[model samples]
Target: MNHQDHQDHQAVGASVDRVAKQVIDAGLKVHRALGPGLLESAYEHCLAHELGLRGLPVRRQVPMPVTYDGMELDAGYRLDLVVINFNARLFRDGVRRFAL
Candidate 1:
């Protein structure tokens, strides 16, 4: 890649890293406040709220589309939480999936 392209990629990576950190921090805050034993949905809602309070746009239960045989289809797969712009997917099991 050219110098400009490299710089752009670095910038995007930095942004993703920042957002990921924020999401992680927010999730921790939620967990610490609520503790364990609650349903996954409870944690998902709380985390989304916490992230929103942190100024991150969050969408819950986002449908994920898949490509099958060159066709885009809704496979009933849903993301627990999607932090907009950064496209960070947060689940209750502390497993993070990013579509950056």
Candidate 2:
């Protein structure tokens, strides 16, 4: 591979790492501020607010519909938060993203 191509790949990887750290920091901040014993919605809302305060756009309760053979069964599988700049959608169940 060319040197320039390697450098570009390294830069992109670094950027992704930085974004991941930022997201984790934001989540920690939310946990610290709110503490425990709260519902998922509460945490989701706080995380969204925290990310927004950091000048990042956050999407909450995003509809995730499921489609079957010629039919659709959307059992209300909503994404808890879709934080921008990280290329991922953090769910109450787990973190989900496409080909990071």
Candidate 3:
């Protein structure tokens, strides 16, 4: 494999989460099934297949445009994972509030 190919795979390899170990396991399962002969798209589809079996939401080719001054900036990259509305709650004086 070329250096760039090695870097590409490394870039997508994230630290496995204990709570999300199942996700990583699912990815590995896909990898094992397809092996290394297929293209990246095939691997992604297989991974998504496993994730779907686990009732996980998988959005492909999700566009994540950056915004500046209320203008949408079409950056060249997209986010693989976008978790929205994960803000924690804060309670003080018997009042519930959203944490920044």
Candidate 4:
């Protein structure tokens, strides 16, 4: 990549890192407030709200499309929460994945 492209990539990476940290911190706050034993949906809702309060745009129950035999289709797969601008997805099991 050219120098400009490399710089752009770095900027995006930094943004992602910031968002990831915020997400993790928000999650910890939620867990500490609510503790364990609640349904996953309850945690998902609380975490999304926490992230939103932190100024991140969050989408819940986002459809995840898949490619099968050269065809893209909605296979009923859904992401628990997605931080739209940051391209970060949080799964039901408390895993975070970035599409960078």
Candidate 5:
């Protein structure tokens, strides 16, 4: 990657971190209000909607693109959520990978 690309990646990473913090905060609110009685899927869906309402850009079910034999192969590896800012300066690539 060139310098410009590196800068872009850095900017994207910052935006991702910011949005990720917001998502975490929203998730905490949900956990507090709803507790652990509900199923994980239900909570996940609700949190996704809630994050969208907060003016955050979210992409769901994004495929993980891989390069194989000089060809781009989109595997079924999907990201549960991707957060990005309007300027594309900051971005969080995926959330599901971090879920424990």
Candidate 6:
């Protein structure tokens, strides 16, 4: 990669790290407030709420489609949550993405 592209990649990676930290902290706060007596769905909703309160955009229960030979298939993969931001992984241009 060129120097500019390398710098951009570094910036995106740093951003992902920072956002992940924020999300982790938010989830921890939720867990601390409400102990582990609830269902997974409860934790999921609360985490989303907490992140939203922090002004972060979050997508939940996102469908994951597998592609093969220009065909997209429903492979039963799903992301529990996706936090959208410049630091978040993007799959545009047929690129594989990392979790944030």
Best by lDDT: 4
Candidate 1 lDDT by residue in tens digits, 2-51: 99999987987787788899988898899999999999999999999899
Error of 5 at 37 (Å): 5.9
| Residue 13 lDDT, candidate 2, scale 0-100 | 73
Per-model C-alpha RMSD: 5.5, 5.5, 15.9, 5.2, 5.2, 3.8
lDDT of 2 by residue, 1-100 (tens): 8999999879867875766777788888999989999998898988888888887778888887777897768988986777653433433333534342
Query: Which regions of candidate 6 are displaced past 4 Å?
Result: 68-70, 85-100
lDDT of 2 at 96: 34
**Residue-by-residue lDDT tens digits, candidate 4, 61-82:** 9887787898879989997887
**Evaluation by TM-score, superior candidate among 3 and 4:** 4
Candidate of highest TM-score: 4
Q: How many pairs of residues collide in model 6?
A: 0
Please, what is the whole-model Cα lDDT of each candidate in the order they appear? Answer: 0.81, 0.75, 0.57, 0.82, 0.72, 0.81
Expressed as tens digits, the lDDT of each residue in 1-100 for candidate 6 is 9999999989877877777788889988999999988998999999999999998899889887999899999999887887874543544432335454
Please list the residue runs of candidate 2 whose C-alpha ends up more than 4 Å from where it truly belongs after superposition. 1-9, 67-73, 85-100
Superposed by TM-score, candidate 2 places the C-alpha of residue 98 at a distance from the truth, in angstroms, of 14
Off by over 4 Å in 5: 1-17, 37-39, 85-100
lDDT per residue for candidate 5 within 30-62, as digits (tens), equals: 788789989877877777788889988777766
Q: Which ten residues in a row have the lowest lDDT in candidate 5?
A: 88-97
Each prediction's total of clashing residue pairs, residues at least 3 apart in sequence or on different chains, is 0, 0, 0, 0, 7, 0
Error of 5 at 45 (Å): 1.1
Selected candidate, larger TM-score, 2 vs 6: 6
Query: Candidate 1 regions off by >4 Å?
Result: 86-100
Q: How many residue pairs of model 1 clash at the backbone?
A: 0
Off by over 4 Å in 4: 85-100
